[model samples]
Target: MAVRDPAIDHLLELLAPLGAATARRMFGGWGVYLDGEIVVLFARGVAYAKTDALTRADFAAAGSAPFVFESRGRTVETSYWSLPEAALDSSEALRPWAQLALAAARRKPVARKARSGEDRRG
Candidate 1:
């Protein structure tokens, strides 16, 4: 099994009392799950929250940018934005942004198909 990132643990600690949050390995990086949905990623020493109006505003104020990855000579974006140190430092600063991200992420997730080949649309 792959190891969980420290940044993820810190983020999870900060986002408690809102929902179930944890880190799962995906595509050689860390994915932050809230209420069983992926809401962010801890990749390359950066804490990225889900892309949304509130989170984006906080991200901008913190002077953080989005997660831009280079792959196959092209730039790719995830449903994530950079996290600022102030947000991390302030006790309640990260919660609002986190909650918003979680709300958005809870809208999308993967579930197993039924054994009888019927789709369980969620």
Candidate 2:
């Protein structure tokens, strides 16, 4: 069995007020979900909240950086932004940002395309 990270446990505890937040291994780190929707991505011990145009400015104003990574020799910036340092202190501090992330997650459009070897037409 794989060992759990204490940092992740602490993060989950801090997010308890936001509902039953859970973490799963993802992209070499972890993805934090609430209500079956992914609202945060935890990588390198940093938590990033989902963001859209509506909340991106708030994250930027907080001096939070967008999640960026190199893929296929290209740098890619994701819609996820780091949660403000203050938010890590407690659930109360993180509530507003977490809610914003949940809102952004719900606002995201779902993909309608079928993958390879799959057909949507019946």
The estimated TM-scores of all candidates read 0.73, 0.89
> In angstroms, what RMSD does candidate 2 have relative to the true structure?
3.0
Candidate 1 lowest-lDDT run of ten: 104-113
Question: Model 1, which residues run further than 4 Å from truth?
Answer: 53-58, 107-122
Report the C-alpha lDDT of model 2 over 62-82, residue by residue, as the tens digit: 999999999999999999999
Candidate 2 lDDT at 53 equals 92
- Compared with the true structure, model 1 gives a TM-score of 0.73
What clash count does candidate 1 reach? 0
State the lDDT at 66 in candidate 1: 84
C-alpha lDDT values of all predictions: 0.74, 0.91
Model 2 spans > 4 angstroms off: 115-122
